[model samples]
Target: MAPKPTSSIRSFASSDRFLAEIATDARRPGYVLAGDESFLYQRCRAGVLAELAPPDQRDFCLHDLDLAEVPIFDVLDRAQTPSLMVPFQVLFVRGLKTLYGRGQKKEEFAAIDAYFRRPNPSALIIFVADHLSIPTDLRRMDMQDKERFERIRETLGDWCGIVELSRVDEGDAARWLAAEAVTRNTQIHPDAARELVDALGADMMLIASEFEKLALYAQGKQLFLIPPQHDQAQPVADIPTPTITLGDVETMVLAAKQRSLYELTDAISAKDRPRALALLHGLLNASDGGEDSAIGHLYMLARTFRQMLIILEKNVRDSRAIWSVLWHGFRMPPFAAEDLIRQARRYKSRADLTRALRLIARADLEIRSSPPDKRLVLERLILALASEPKPAASGSFHQFAIDL
Candidate 1:
């Protein structure tokens, strides 16, 4: 038979994977149970420790007993016996379905009932886990999953309480870096710290290791200086996006006005006028139901032209940042922001910019005010913006404000 296709979900080899692997003829040297992903890595170590130790600090180890076939009296003796040869012993049985609902299998009611009745007293029972996914098969099984979970909690009694593991959220990454910097006495600016997050791209371990590098590099170096050695890492965090800049915000604003005129121009050059205008109409609707949006669109076109002039004047090679600036303001549609900068310069002319902005202003007015033929008005606006005239110092900014 062909092998089952692998799961497409992209979490760290998650607890669910571990659980799915448990007792499906993949048993370890000992028995294994399915568990939760959220608590898997964390509880595994401590659970293993507990399973290896004596339950009551009595001088005994579960290893001394035949895990497969120890007699009741012999096992009882082992638990009661104080010994120099053996220390505390814990029995290990995993896969508590109470903590983790059965995913594609039937609930092991009989197994659970038997296990609870004669639980090896030496074992420090544990339920390790990740995230939960209710299995499709269980929906047809009539398993009262919640009730079973409650039953397990009752069976465990005071012997076990749920222990939570800490996972970091996006908001905490910057603060974490700042703390790391302080610990190492390195002056990591907030932007630099944020860049660290970007570099690691939400990989917490990677972020942690990089922050450690900051500490390591700081040693034997001047306390007042951060060495240039650590600057070469091309991690996204180093991209200097500490806070949302005004330019970045402006791109989003322009994008909301309609699709970016700069991008549309390429389509127009390819004689794809309809496609170009569609983008314009989309931007036109973004400004909300107001005349200000019309005006805002014009200013946005002017601004893009302004940026283009600046780039040309400065003779800047950093085209990527220019595009990021556009993505932030004009709200470029979702795609990689890296390539759009060079693209922005392609359909460039001051005249085109002026016309596009003027078109946006007109669309904003028609959409907002008492204008007839809304659809036709939009189509006209799209054409005007997509194939705007060359600049001649005729830019209009009639105040397009979004009423919050």
Candidate 2:
């Protein structure tokens, strides 16, 4: 017997499964979408809206409410009342965290339980708990989010179906990129898909947006086709398929930003503190969230340092060798292979790279603690990483000095 295909072996994304469920139209009276993955959240929302509220009858059938502005009782009342203009109603409720705020929500829970007992046959309610962030791997979910997830299960899960919208895995994201390209009458080169996913850190929204630009770029490219040879009666012509290459991604996507990231790493590796700080400021200024994006910058920094550690441990000397060392979904873009190898060589040993990762982790914790000045924390981290290691002391204190 032949082996099973990869798609068959791997579980489908939660968002995809939810979309399929929406197509059947055999949904429950209410549901709770649990996660902060906006990409998957939007996908599920679009699927629900497309099924429940067609463009022609959207205004009459669809309703958007927030618990922060409107009370749950009013929302339940809206759901209970039937609309004269439309046959069915769909309510999207946001700010679910407000329900679990201070004090016991006995009245609110009672109202919800009573409403669900005899729900209107013509209406559907969807509660969006976007405040909880769910990672691709459930085992690694944050403790607070895990608690929040369980709380919902204990309460709302009794009356509503819970659909998790977790982050997409890198491999799944890349496969989706290829399949999505095919839907656009274009083929995405495997390398291009990998590069795109790695570059965006498997952010589906960014991948989807960049893929649109890539598809358009591929479609608009001038095709060079050879004329079919003259035949006696009729000629068979071969049509060429448009393909999105890696070069296209590097040209169209946020390649400049990635390049700046590499440049920052380069400065750090070379022990140039001034240049590294300058590059850091440039990165922050160019970002949409300014200092708020410090976490994202720290994430990328940690990833690059980890890559350098692997390169150092494997003794990878060139780009060709680097591929064999770095596994798929963890590899960097081809353009940075040589630069990374050079940077990795600058470190005296794996200890140096490990120290860098440790410093990054400290900075991450500080930023998460809601520091008054996130920029200063990042600057201190950079300064620490770019500084030369202290010379080892002779005697019993040598190990202690190295630990410091």
User: TM-scores across all candidates?
Assistant: 0.30, 0.64
Model 1: lDDT equals 0.43
State the lDDT of candidate 2 residue by residue for 253-315, as single tens digits.
Answer: 875368889999999999999999998888876665445589889998999999999999999
lDDT of 2: 0.83
lDDT of 1 by residue, 1-404 (tens): 11121234223223334334432444222232222323234334433444344355534443433323443334334434455555434443333443343353223443433454554443333343223222223343224543554455554433343332224334455665565455454555666555555533334555666556554544434423444555546443423222322232233322222335555545644446788777667665544634455555545555554555444444445643454344334433333132234544554544444444555565666667757655566566555544435333435444322111
lDDT by candidate, in order shown: 0.43, 0.83
Pairs in clash, predicted candidate 2:
none
lDDT of 1 at 132: 28
- Counting clashing residue pairs in each candidate, in order, gives 38, 0
Give me the displacement of residue 29 in model 1, in angstroms: 22
